[model samples]
Target: MTDQTKIRSGGRAARRAARAAPLPDHMRPVRAGLTGGAYRPLTADGMDRIHAAVLDALEQIGLADAPPSGVAYLTGAGASLGTDGRLRFPRTLIEDTIARANRSITLMGRDPAHDMELSGARVHYGTAGAAVHLVEVDGRTYRECGVQDLHDAARIADTLDNIHFLQRPMVCRDISDNLEMDLNTIYACCSGTTKHVGVSFTDPSYVAQAAEMLHMIAGGEDKWRARPFISNSNCFVVPPMKFATESCLVMEECIRHGIPVLLLSAGMAGATAPSTVAGAIVQALAECLAGLVYVNAVQPGHPAIFGTWPFGLDLRSGAMTGGSGEQALLTAGCAQMHKYYDLPGGAAAGIADSKLPDMQAGWEQMCSNVTAGLSGLNMVYEAAGMHASLLGFCHESLILGDDLIGQALRCVRGIEVTEETLALDQMRAVCMGGPGHYLGTEQTLGRMETDHVYPRLGDRTSPKEWSELGKPDLLAKATARKAEILSRRSAAAFDPALDKALRERFVIHLPR
Candidate 1:
């Protein structure tokens, strides 16, 4: 061969060798719990002003419709019952509650390895919703989600790397009884994934029974307490400054039973909450702080996630726009407020307004996911696979969302320009004497997988190569991945003995 041909062949060989296998989980370009907060939507003064308004809202208007027990708790903690029937929280009481609130807490997984430590600006993304419908990716249609769908959703999330935890996403429409539905929700999520699961209970009395089942799954109450894998996603307050009586009772039961509570205040802007973005945030904070006060009064420093999920509404039509830029701002602003209080916090993001996982969904999902990460959100829920404004969940979209979240996390990682990373010496070497390009360089090769994230479902080939590969279909690829993951998932989630016992005890809706 000619000398030129020999040199080209050697370069190609080195490039191939350098671009080796994908990095291990630890060495991947992006993973769960990466630091966010690169974006600051609210300045220090803006944050302070909003916080001051929040304090004023609680002290003045406060919240109505507190449960009798909740009233006692609030009154006992320096809150006053107004003649107008509003339970007004004193400034001192609210500040004291914030002081005593649990700033850091570990959200344990069924397997300890998946446990998430939430504090400061650490970020975690996971699935969460009450979507009642399924957006079939292949058929491009919708259907009511059943009990099995919820279980399958958890199973799908289990195999995904970027999806860090499982929150009961779908409502099991097949289950008729409320108690049975609650138990089945817990069972389905716990049985499908070992990741930390978030669940919601309908009534206060159901908690003990559910706790017993969780105890069984965790080997015993002691072990469960040691590493509680579940948390109560309680919508403790109704929007417009009112306490949800039943949910407040449930929250009380959750705190009493040693279950961590997520004090979720989901107020729709321009509808349930004030139309202005800042106003929405003020209301969310007021309600959640009331919950914090209640939890502290019941038991000092109880684990509670400050959940301030204020969704945007199309003021013209009064429709929920979970994917709107306003939604992203609201969530990011709430994250800053969480930072202001130094509490473990969570908010909703990554919901697609589109009915399907198409281009619209792409733009919508990425906008919030990226902003949430950059805003340093502690936990970003509904960050994948949700469609139809959270009315539908798709398996294929979820698989594809894993890729989307991977890219967003890489963005959150941003660019690290340290002494070693600056690459000044390497640049000089290449420019002065080495090859004119970096394609086959040692540093470039080493960073192939470490510095760059590769997508499994996304195409990265030239047009000629793509056509040669028969014009790959993104949806079809996601479908095949979903099937492979579900089929290859190892073992039934529980052993026969434990499985049979659980079945006999509760009306287990899911068949083996």
Candidate 2:
């Protein structure tokens, strides 16, 4: 080879080696729990107005249809029962509960290594939703999601570095019984991935049996209480100042069993909530604030996430618009409210209104995910795999979402300004007697891993090189990665004996 060709080859080899080298957890460009809070869609005055409106809604409008137990819980904690049978929280009572709420919480993974500390503006993204269908990898068809599909999604999430945790994403449509479905949902998620799992019980009566199953998994009630890896994603309120009676009962039961709770208040903008975004946010906050009071009333300082998930609506057709810019503004606005209260918060984002993982899906998912991350949402739920306004889940989209979220998190990390980063010295070196460029410098090599995030499936190849490699696109690459991940047994799989015991105890539909 000519000397010039040899030099080029050696330079390429060194750059490739640098890219291959791993950095420590702190040094990596992105990971779980990066601080957000940078994008404030709500101004300070706007947030205050929303807060005041929320307070008024809780105190004056109140909520109807609380279970008797919930009435006792709230009334005992200084709330009043009106002649109209509505439960009302006093302004002071709500403020006091916020004062006593848990400021920070460590969401423990079944494996300690995956624990995420949620506080301040710390942001983490993960999969969530009870999507009923699996958007087939073919990208055009759908089928009822069985227990095996849920397990496979968890297994896939376990392998992806950017997917921080796995919530029960899809319903086990094959399971007919509610009790069996709830138990098996927990079993499938826990057994598939050691990451923290979230599940919701269908009925309050199911909680006892589910607790027993959880105890069996944790070795005992004490161990489970000490490090409860699972959280109850309870929708305590329906919408527009009303309690979901059955869900309230379930939340109370889950709290008694020492499981953490997500106070989810999902209202549609034009349907359940007011059509205006501000009005929708106020209602969501009011509903979640009531839930916060309910949880703290049951047990003070209990780990409850302020889940204010208000979705957007296409007013023209009354359809849910999960990917609209209005939805992004709503989520971002809610996140600012969470920061105002200094509470750990979660909200929905990254959903695709599009039925397929096409270019439309890409833009839709990225818009919400980027906005959520930038606004510092603590638990950005549905941050992956959701399609058709959250009716379907896709493995290929989930894999693609890992790359998407990686880029979003880089935006969350933002630009760090410091002496070294200013690069005055490096600039001086380059302009003086140096290489006339920053590439291949000592600083460049050192910052490569720390300063930039690389995508696993996103293609960056040039036209000629892309043609050489058979011209791959994002979907093709994601399909291959998903297949490769599912081809092997998961490293996070449960122990054989434990799996056997769980299967024997519960009607688990997933195969061993």
Candidate 3:
């Protein structure tokens, strides 16, 4: 076997052994199917309102005043690498071409998606950074993760998927140490992925410190100044939320440094912005556009990722419930808006407000993720278990989310039609011969790989066979699969000196 394949196999085996013990019933993932479709498109008037908002943003806000490189990245947002040797931007087509191109670029082992890459995909397992507060395993709960946990998590994630970036755990249950908590979490949790890291810091010095660490990790000043692993300058603008001055300053620094910024807006229908879905979308668009304008005005050519994550408030309880129709609408709307600017867009998926994995969580996560995928979003965040979302994380939920994302990716492949799919010759052969010999034909063999949906966890065997194999349910199968993946833990190659340097530079404090 190839060295890479061997490493992967061994790593999976190792992870599986670590999680060999059966999961408790409360921790097992809940099984639930898709809910009935209930989507409503915006009306003509609503569309007009949205159009006006976009126009206002373009004219009034304009681009931020940034360096040449920043301008090249920003104004060139949707520009594609053309065969003619020139950059091409489609004014008429507002799609996630930039993000798609970025994804393609990153997959080729480069930093193309910029900051979005860090926010988009990658795996980091274990308790570390901010995650220390959120992860409860082996009779441990709410314990702050130190530096050791962060490296361990990074190592675990590294052993799994090619973790491209890192996110600080939901450390600091209260808001007091939000910045320190987030930075420490990010520093500990991510390594050997991409150099990029993210945090929603509202303190200028803290943002600078984070930026400095990012610079250090990227090798030196030259690499740091070049990109410095795109850090986000995130802020909330709508009611129930207020914009922070530090975030604004960080956005300026990001623009000056050519770092990509994401203008995030989170609002709840009926409570924060509007009562209807369309109104909420419009408000979200307005908020994001305003941030875009500010960023562009400061540094016109700065790279940016447009984002919207608005949900509905349970009017009776005034709680922000993530698994709601509003969440799906917001996700879809963000993709649509990205098309308008020909820019990459961001939306949250795989989140449930439920404290545990349940029918509510499953349906909510599935609908939102499917909507984002169908809308052709450039990047979808929170693609794993985010319970009481913006509140906690569940390991089983993350596994289930991985499954859901796989399905969504399959959906995005759309329907393919080819000569083999037509199968005219095969049909004729079957008709002439009789009953059902076509299953053994070459055409069937050729088409099976493409036409069939082979689920990784779902039951497809006959009842007798299934019973004989231990009568495992979908959840049980998923659990087993997750264990299998964890068992094969092999390390990825990295510069030992650099890894050691980063660890030495950043120190984590653990309370005794």
Which candidate achieves the best TM-score against the true structure? 2
Residue-by-residue lDDT tens digits, candidate 2, 1-512: 99999998898788778778776788889999999989998888999999999999999999999999999989999999999999888999999988888889989898898898889999999999999999986647999999999998999999888899998899999999999999989988987899999999999999999999889888899999999999999999989789999999999999999999999999999899999999999999999999998998889888999999999999999888999999999999999999999999999999999998989999999999999999999999999999999999999999999999999999999999999999999999999999899988878987888898889888888999999988887787788887888899888777788888887877877777
Residue lDDT tens for model 1, 1-512: 99999998898787776567555668878887898888989999999999899889999999999999999998999999999999998888888888877879999998877889999888999999999998897778999998999988899888888999989889999998999999999989988999999999989999999999999998999998888899999998999899999999998899888899999999999989998888999999999999899888888888899999999999888889999999999999999889999989999999999999999999999999999999899999999989988999988888999999999999999999898799988899899998877876778876777888889899999999999999999999998888887786433298779989999999999878
The global C-alpha lDDT for each of the candidates, from Candidate 1 onward, is 0.91, 0.92, 0.52
- Residue lDDT tens for model 3, 38-127: 222454465667867544543344333333433354445543333432222343222333223222111111144323221222211111
| Candidate achieving the largest lDDT | 2
Model 1 scores a C-alpha lDDT of 0.91
TM-score of each: 0.96, 0.96, 0.70
Candidate 3 Cα RMSD after full superposition onto the native fold (Å): 11.2
Model 1 clashing residue pairs (backbone): 37-376
Look at candidate 3 and tell me the lDDT of residue 492: 30
Which regions in candidate 2 have their CA more than 4 angstroms from the true location?
1-19
Model 3, position 478: C-alpha lDDT score: 50
